[model samples]
Target: MSEKYLIGVDGSEQSRVALAWGLARATERGADVELLHVADDSFLSESVAFLSEAQKASEQMLNAEIEYARSLGFTGKITGNAVVGHPIAELEEASRSADLLVLGAHSGSRLAGSFFGTRAVKAAATAHCPVAVIPNNDANPNAAVVVGVDGSEASKKAIAFAAEEASFRGLALVAVYAWMPPLTPGLEYLWSEELVDSQRSAAEEAIAIGVAGLATRYPDLEIRREIVQAPPVAALVQAAEGAELVVVGSRGRGGLSRLLLGSVSHGVLQALPCPVIVTRA
Candidate 1:
């Protein structure tokens, strides 16, 4: 069966940008595109007429997005679904069978409650498959793909996904591990260069373990390692300045298993430098 890529669609220009990104990827992989538009019925009254009108509007939006995809020369199979429900919930449910879930990053609003903002992160955190959040702006054509690495199952999955992406795109792969020295508040004098070096060494080891066999798997892909003495989110954001894409795990080693999204992932999503893909094992 052909691979399926599900995308969340709104009538916004950001969603159109995401549609273009998704269609280009689908065309490359010969995958079917599934466009989903969910009208936010949570705030609407229970009146049947109101719900009917909302559903009708959603269908129109979905159809327009489908036409947009066709206009972009995506010749593969395309499917559209318009539903009246919470956008995040519907997208999460629809992503179960998809190979990837794509969403638009809202440029005008903060990521808390904005459409396709926090909602995109929320869907990415819980989606069964990987989720790609495409920004409205274009990526740097000459930059490599960056992936966050740590000695965690989630980061391992991210490394694999990022390596595959870089190989397919014929771009370099940058695996980054950011570490900060553990300093006690009252014992600031105890912090020294030796302790910092120890932390750096540990970070290096973790990153090495995270990308153990990628060289054999992707012989042609150029892989680079980045060990930064900073916070994970800040380091990743900096590394993504000129990156084509950024890949990060949903959760990290320090994050609790019950945490759907790690602090780093959430922070990266909030300040997305480029199109970010949150991967899951």
Candidate 2:
């Protein structure tokens, strides 16, 4: 079966941006695109007439988005659907069968919350497959694909995904491993150069292990390594300054069982440096 990308559409400008990005990617990979619009009927559940009108409006919006996709010259198989339900629940359900879930995030000052006002984050955290979050603004035109690696099972999956994307796009791949000295709040006096160097060496080794056999797998791909002595979020956000796409694991080594999204993934999602793909293990 052809690959399928599920994109959430809400008639917002951000959603339009996501539609374009998803369609372009689908066209590139010869994949199908499914645009979904969920009309929240929570408030209007008691009013049958209002619910019906809202559903009609949602369908209209979907039709318009489909036309917009065609206008962008997307010739692949495209379908749109409108349903009455909670957006997050509907999207989560649909994403289970999709190869990818793509959403749009508002950029600049309008980012009051994470992409899609926390909905994107929730979807990404709970998605059964990979989730791609595209920002409203374009990424650096000449940058390579970037992936965060922490030698965890989840990050290993991210590395594979990033390598495949870079290979297919004919772009370089940057594997980043960020590490910081282990220090407690009141233990600044114990800080030493040796500790820093030890951490750096460990980071290098971790990254080396994380990217092992990648060259063998993607023989033609160019892979670059970056080891930064900073917080994972800061390091990744900086590395993504001009990145085409940033791929990260949904959970990291320090991830708690209660948290669906790791600190790194959640932080990176909030940063919105570029188009980010959060992959699951």
Candidate 3:
């Protein structure tokens, strides 16, 4: 139940696309929307007149985006803020009060949309709220909501978010849990059919237990479970081929200590087919 979203706007087509998505979600849930435009002062020219012009341009762009959203049938309360600061830090601090933060991927080919470049990734990793990275080429709005789940706290949070999204959109929820049975041990004694079957069964049970209460929470939402015996990143990317959205935990059970995002999540973010949400809780 995200009741508010803060979208970062930079006057780019991708940012406008993200605003559209955020506004649509806000309108659907009767939520409030906040548009934040961080005018990178570092990029501003040294002249005082140029600085004033840049500030005015940023504010006008924010206003224009709000008007554009309104024209597109968004009735939710829309507020705009044009500030002079670093975009990532500004967005991350502002995210503390917002239910979610929406950002746009860098402008480029659709295949490159998988990676949000530096700004999106920095804000997502440090934001206090969940971050939704919208790609530029999300032309088809109708696609299943896919989630990556494991028996971890972060994955459970992702499952809850994905389930709510599926329920709201009236779409099916595809829960994917990827596991790799130790098939690399070249010894025959270590690679048997029974062992692989047991591993698969355990993985399936984990997924079931992980999302046990989803049906009760979303009675009308359809839930589908898939167990992929491959690498987590590869399995998730393949599953998200035609999905409308992909959601995953920012980190997993064995996440690295140095980075905020785990290997699987990092890979999925870099190569998902559509918009991707990385949960912070």
Candidate 4:
């Protein structure tokens, strides 16, 4: 596992919100925060050919973000650095060494507004450590912490991490499991209430098995389980309402099926009201 740290200030307003959240988390953990602004030379290669100028501006922004963090009573040390490369690649490389990578998701881009923005999607897909994608609207303090479990190794790791977070913050952990009836042509229309209930029960049982060990480890942590009959992505996004943090496994039993079925983690990270942590197995 990488060292515990939070990151912020990636040159977007959404990132500023993410920075604030990361700063608060770092303060709580008594850990350091690295304010990084990667200058993607490829993006501005033609517009701003001067690498030094871009680096200098990035450094200045990093310093300002660090100062803001300090003003917010984050006495923990803050380090600022600027690197020139592809934003996604550099961030992924940095995440290999950091405990957590926090990123801000912009709400204005229509492309991103509908799904995980390009940068956030790339980082989440490639990052080695947990990546927290923070939305701009999450400012509440009493929101619950939500996680999605599908009885996979990655989901199990996500549950363990989320349970620890909920225990540490004294917040409720809401575990969600999404189930759907088989899509066979005639079988699809044949769906019945009994089948739905049975599927939901099985999902709940799987969630219980996935969380049993963590619940034992954190006996005092408050947890709630939900089995929803919806697409995994939609179910997780809905559960993220009023949540301070959301956790999801990078890969699940669905496996390479993710390419065709889509990823619940990607969906939640794109639309969630709060930050999302994606854990790898």
Against the true structure, whose TM-score is highest?
A: 1
In candidate 1, stretches whose alpha carbon ends up further than 4 angstroms from where it belongs are 252-260
Q: Please provide TM-scores, in order, for all candidate models, with all chains considered together.
A: 0.94, 0.93, 0.87, 0.87
Model 3 error, position 25 (Å): 1.0
lDDT comparing candidate 3 with the true structure: 0.80
Candidate 1's displacement at residue 110, Å, is 3.4
Stronger candidate by TM-score (1 vs 2): 1
For model 2, the superposed segments whose C-alpha errors exceed 4 Å read 109-115, 252-259
Q: How high a TM-score does candidate 1 get?
A: 0.94
Clashing pairs in 2: none
lDDT of each: 0.86, 0.86, 0.80, 0.74
Best by lDDT: 1
lDDT of 2 by residue, 179-254 (tens): 8777789998797888778888998899999889989988999999999888999999899988999999876323
C-alpha RMSD by candidate, in order: 2.3, 2.4, 3.3, 3.5
Which lDDT tens digits does candidate 4 get at residues 33-100?
A: 78777766875655455877888877887777777778777777778777776777787678777888
Model 2 lDDT-worst window of ten? 251-260
lDDT of 3 by residue, 1-281 (tens): 54779998876777778888888888878888998987887777779898788789889988888788789888768898987767777887898899989988753332232223556766777778888988777444778899998898888999999999989899999999999865555575776788889989999899999789889988998999999989998899888887888998875223442245677776776674688898875
